[model samples]
Target: MVAVRLSADSNGVLETPRDGDRMSAISRRALLTTTAGAAAGLAVAGCGAAGGGKQGAPRAQRTGEHSGASGARAPAKTVRLIGDGSTADTGPQPNQPVVDRLEPGQTPPQFVVFSWDGAGEVGNGLFPRFRKLADDHGATMTFNLSGLYLLPEDKKLMYAPPNGPLGASDIGYLSDEHIRMTLDNLRQAWTAGHEIATHFNGHFCAGSGSVSRWTPADWKSEIDQAVAFVTQWKTNTGWYDEEPLPFDYAKNLIGSRTPCLLGQDNLLPTAAAIGWRYDTSNPGGDQIWPSKRMGVWDYPLQLIPFPGHSFEVLSMDYNMLANQSHAATSSDPRNYPGWRSQATASYIAGFQRAYETNRAPFFIGNHFEEWNGGIYMDAVEETLKHIAAQGYKDVRMVSFQQLTDWLDAQDPALLDKLRTLEVGEQPPGGWKEFLGQVPASTATGGAGEGAAPAVTATT
Candidate 1:
């Protein structure tokens, strides 16, 4: 029940002013407010903050089974438990794509981050379905797990969210069966190299004492609750038969998407204090290289081409839904085809805008929902296929964590240069001259210059 702020048109997309002016969804004043249910922070939700805070990406270690290019199977890594035997370090993240720094003359790859809010595997099957989709495409994504999704309704009292009464949540706990399903999916996701991030617990929005009202102390409470739920799932669920998650939540969790994209001003500090690496709660930002806010990466939702509209919408399904159907989660049957097309086109246009111009990492957000006849889901799958299509070299469907690793490895000056390009603007004098480096032998033409090979960094 996070306030679907601005009552979206199709489902979760906010109803923007008819004039189509962008950037009005969230206000600066709202973010500065210590008030309880208003909106704040406008990069559009990420998946962020400033300063060179102490957080760094965990060093890579070998994990699971792997095969050499020569086709010989590598020995499996031993699983080492971290804490309470709830999570284990099996080694380099299995199936995690190689992430390396961009060379002096390399053009940044078109990194598209496909992330979800309240990620859970339920009867809908969308979770497993997309997991297969990612594997099919050799892509990775971030799953913003809503903590309560791992908590059964019977264990609701265990949550105790910030500011609200005990066990109080706008969106209540899931069924025990669903919780187990969520657990299964979460474990599989990590093993497959997908990132597990947060959407916090209790999902407060305006009128329900939304998180927007909470202070850093309030946010810490929320963060602690979220962490406890993931790390203590075995203890909470008491499902001894089930194996624990494959990674340490305390070590693994580094990013989040605040509910409704609210309360980031406070959330950033809380994130930094806990050594988190990023926050994705900004409401609206352009296609540009991300920088640190509050000392961590602020990977906010971007404002991208909205196809027919003059104002670009946040790259999120809810915004698309609002623009098409005015907050109607279920639309007229007749509108399905057009809505799907519009949604698909928006995603492609947004991707192309960055692909052609700035090469800023695209942060696309979605929920595991069956809204608007499931048109958004169809649109995302189609868009991903298009991104991975032939001739699209250097394109990756990455998780926010993977994207951050790659970004952190780059030179600050090079990223600053990237931020100079406008929408659809190509580099002047081409890639080699612009970046002052030579292309690899395997890479053909100008595109090869920025396509650096992947690297592994071990602690």
Candidate 2:
């Protein structure tokens, strides 16, 4: 969940609008607060994130299992366990598409990333539900797992968040059973070709200890702790009988979305220092092509079309709920149907705006919760199915890491040209004419240039 500071005018209209006024007039129904109950409920209910697979494309065989071109079977996977045997170094991830540079005249794929926050199970079956949904639609996604979710409640004080109480976290720690479930899902998600990123731990979104005020050092400490929790879960839980997570998280973690979208400004410096590829913590970004921030990709939650409203909302489920039901988790049930439809339309509108025009990547953030009779979840499902029905080979539903792979493969000049496209604006004379002439000499640091970096299936 990204953090936002929205204020309405006397007429109750959102301020400082942009993207052709799409960001204007969002109803001032409620102040999107980061209350302890809301944060803890999101974590206790299901404190983790999710990933998906791309539709219409054949899943790639795991690297080390076959020759890339000849299709010849290769050697078996070699798994080397890491610290405390909580994680391992498996070969390339399975089902990863072979990323290549876009040829001249080739239109870029419509990349849609559906990420979950606080991705925990908690007996709700949402983790598996979305996993199955991704498989069914051939989409790949990013699951932002909260480190605290894996830390046993008994060991809660083990966490030391900056400026916050030692071992204190706004989000609740998971039960032992739920921790095991989260681990199981994470292992499966990794093997099945989804990206597992971090959501940090102890969501502190307000007051003096809020992540919004954390410094670079504080951010680094948080990141290090998050990594330790993920890599040392075995020590924390003493559940040696459980299977180790299938990938080396230290290497696999190339990106993250901060809790409640806080602390990104400080987090980016640490993220770049630690060699992370991207951060998706910025809120209220327009639906335009992304660019690097502090040398890392900045994939912000965008302002998208909101049905029945003159303004736009952040492309997130909770933001929608904030505008629709004023942040009340359980609103009037009779209004659920209309609210659900509005949410679905809003998502679809956001997708269509990007798909039909600038072709910027569409990102949607979610948490596994039954907010407002679970309409948001239903709306997300409907939106994914609708997108899948398009059946366009160029409409790629990929994870953040996978998208990074593609971005790194492109000519920087071509990317610059792509960035010129404003929200809902099309290429001057269509994609072929627009991107076909990007000078080969201008590739600069792009992978399409000489001596492309050695890319593996894992990243």
Estimate the TM-score of every prediction: 0.80, 0.85
Candidate 2 residue lDDT tens string, 1-459: 234344553322232212121111111112111321221111111122321433332333221111121111223566688889898777777789887777777788899999988766676667777877898888888998888878898898889999988888666677777777677677666766789998888776656777778999999999899899999999999977666787888898999987766667888888888888788887557899888887788898888887776667677887777677666677799989999999899899999999999999999988877778889999999999999998877898889988888787677777778889999999989999998898765443342322234343443
Candidate number with greatest TM-score: 2
lDDT of 2 at 249: 89
Task: Give the per-residue Cα lDDT of candidate 2 at 322.
Answer: 66
Cα lDDT for residue 38, candidate 2 = 28
Off by over 4 Å in 1: 1-77, 82-84, 437-459
lDDT of 1 by residue, 184-241 (tens): 6666677667899988887666544667778999999888888888877777778655
List per-prediction Cα lDDT, in the order shown: 0.66, 0.72
Question: What's the true lDDT of residue 300 in model 2?
Answer: 88
